[model samples]
Target: MWISRLSRFLDSVKQTLFILGTGLVIFLALRNSIVWHMQEFWGASGDFWQRRWEELYLLFNQDDFLLSVFGTYIFTTAVFWLCNLFFILLDLTGKPEFLLKYKIQADKNTPLRPADFMKAAKVALYNQTVVGLPMSVMIFCVMKWRGCSCSPADMPTFPWSVVEVTIFTLVEEIGFYYTHRMFHHPRIYRFIHKKHHEWTAPIGLVAIYAHPVEHALSNLLPVALGPILLGSHLATAWMFWALALFSTTVAHCGYHLPLLPSPEAHDYHHLKFNQNFGVLGVLDRLHGTDAQFRASLAYQRHFLLMSSMPVTQQVPEPPKKKSVSE
Candidate 1:
């Protein structure tokens, strides 16, 4: 009975660990080769970066680095919106035959209405322009005042890049967990976080549909704080931000697509409203906030699904369906 109860849990852990290990190994192994090919093809060498970095330093004086700062934010954010659009379009299609099987809350939630999609998009746009842009400018100013490097030549090596990104993820996880939980406080929820939670079964566009204050503090700060504390190179910062955006979008995306991490955990958070606050589930597990989630069917359903089969978990084979002969 115990084994039966834990079978799905163990399988989830195994699948997650395997994916993490394989991704780490592949990224580490291919990193140097990828960098070499990039450098060779672009005719970029140590000298080239040195000059470029120097030029960037000089350019900073002329425009106060506004161009680089805004350009990076805009470019990375565009990727996030494009990802949102992809899933939004899919959801708006009313569970097309092909994707219907992948929908996690298919029975409970209705197809995304065009009106709701437009509302989410409008709020997201408002947050991006009104809250996001100013925050980016402020952060850039602070980084400059702190003497943080934004130069091309200051980029971390591939191995160190991996380490830094891992640290950023940890930092973001802690910040996001606490801030997100704080917003769920009963007193504060109605005023600030309520807008975001309106979509219990969230779609990708709902990822950024939040109060401007919540958007800046809860969403952006957790992510930007890591790079700021580390004073990372601009390129590394952008890379991490892009990954964060994509991952958040995927988390809010209702369907479990192939070759991507499962959206079950965060989707469960939206459905249940008090569980799985952190991005990686680190703090959730640590704080026991995931107790309800783990005990629910959603936890059992979590997996890196690779096929078109309905997402499910392994059970203990039902005691071999003992027959009369037994």
Candidate 2:
């Protein structure tokens, strides 16, 4: 039954792929043209950086600034939708069971109604704004005090030794792993992390979607904390953002990819309400949280083999109707 359903879905996906491929080609062409025009204009001036700054300020005249703000909203929403679509495709292709098991688990275990999902979305938005905006301001102040003119283009060239970035990433990962596990403790779960765990079998949107406190703690630790402690460059910070976003999305996707770890590795923890708290495999392995996961996998494999035997298999029947008198 699963195979038949998957085959039909794939047939539909073929059409989707062709349309998506055409749309992407057009989008890339338009984007590249706009970028080229902007670069040409900037390059014509002898003091290109200075002129570019002037252009930005001028372009952001009160009315334009408002329009730009709206534009940002549209751009962000579009990116999020695209990411969601990609994850849906990944779920269909890599783990058809993801969708199949979702209804079963949600009905059985999770208390996630539509209201809960809305609340989580609100929390995610509020927390990101509250934490990210202040951190950005603080970073700007520090950069100004240090006499640094770190702009977007200069981000790639901003001086931070590779060793420093590497050390910072490791430190941040350790902090994240421990803090995440700590939140799962029964004493703290309701206050800090329960909103997130409400979606036991999550889709991609739940990646950064959490209670305000949980969101601030989870997001700020890796991105803001590392930069502040290490005095890292804009480039390092940007790289961290990319890594964090991509990893979080993949983790929440609930599908295993060839190069990435299985979402089953994390999804089970959410379902069972404990264990497997590490972003990567290291901390979970060290703490023995993965032991049950290994055992469960072995049991499932054995069960599948046994169930596949013709002699052991039996067809389930519809229940008999009850009499009106009963």
Candidate 3:
């Protein structure tokens, strides 16, 4: 389940890194319109993004309009791919020694298989294309509704506002925690939030696979909530979105890496529902939703200890049909 340091630079590594390198290039190249989308794409629809909702198509017709529009698409698509690449690499090179060094879960679940991966890939891509584009447009509209501009010249400069980023992430996490837990109500879980629970053992790609309503209510709105509430700069808003996406994906990544967000609790939620509902697990523990899960973790430790103890005597199993030679 591990690879040597020497194999790190082998052909497989070279090819994987090449693809990621190309993706990073595309991600950086489309930077301008990526920021512009939040500022200009639907800047004119400040009304509809709030109370109107019908004027969502409002546009500026400014110079280089076409380029900005195309760039927005390219930028967002690239962002999704880049995020996808990060965890996909973990799952893809699942046996790499580097990954084994950080894996937290003592027991390995089912081996990562191609069929299951393809299914997750299909769902993840569907959510990005379906939910991601519309969400970007909505972010612009809401910014406009709140009287914020998308013009980079007027926006915050290079190197985003970290202070604002932390504040925004905190606000989003709080909102997401409450709303996500609410969605688990027995009356609504079956119809509204059940799609996300389909995968008991989640991978990186499984993070984005949710019903559109869940994506909008729990995922998009909460993330955009902080920026809209604070009226933060466009650049700050974009950075917050990136962070939000990263945290969400990491939570679904089955492995529990030391420095990472500790996704095992979330992993447990997928396997055994009705637990670990909070984004940061704060609410889950405070309200005792994770009490059952924490107890189970302790139990797993005990089981491992019992299994590892030396046996004084061996018990033989019933013999199967004898071999032809025997």
Q: What is the TM-score of each candidate against the true structure?
A: 0.80, 0.56, 0.64
lDDT of 3 by residue, 1-326 (tens): 13433343364345445533564566569877665774464464443333221122133333223222334446555666677685566665666545544333424433557777787778767766677667767776676677654454445433245556656756775788788888889999998789889877777677778887887788777878887877765546656667766777777776555455556677778878888787655455445566688677522321111332211112122358989998
Best by lDDT: 1
At residue 65, give the lDDT of candidate 2.
28
Question: How accurate locally is residue 141 in candidate 3, as Cα lDDT from 0 to 100?
Answer: 67
lDDT of 1: 0.78
Which residue segments of model 3 deviate by more than 4 Å? 1-73, 97-110, 157-160, 294-326
Residue by residue across 1-326, what tens digits does model 1's lDDT show?
A: 66644664565456446544676777668988976785575555545655765675576663546644666667666988888877876787764567766777777445777789889889988988888888888888877766666665465665576678878887898799999999999999999999998988888888899999899999989988888888777666777888998999999988887778889999999998999998887567656688899987788777777766667423211345678998
Question: Tens digit of lDDT per residue, candidate 2, span 164-224?
Answer: 5555556666777787887888898899788788777776668777766666676555555
Ranking according to TM-score, highest score first: 1, 3, 2
Q: lDDT for each of the candidates?
A: 0.78, 0.54, 0.61
lDDT (C-alpha) at residue 308 in model 3: 22
Per-candidate RMSD, Å: 6.1, 14.1, 15.9
By lDDT, rank the candidates, best first.
1, 3, 2
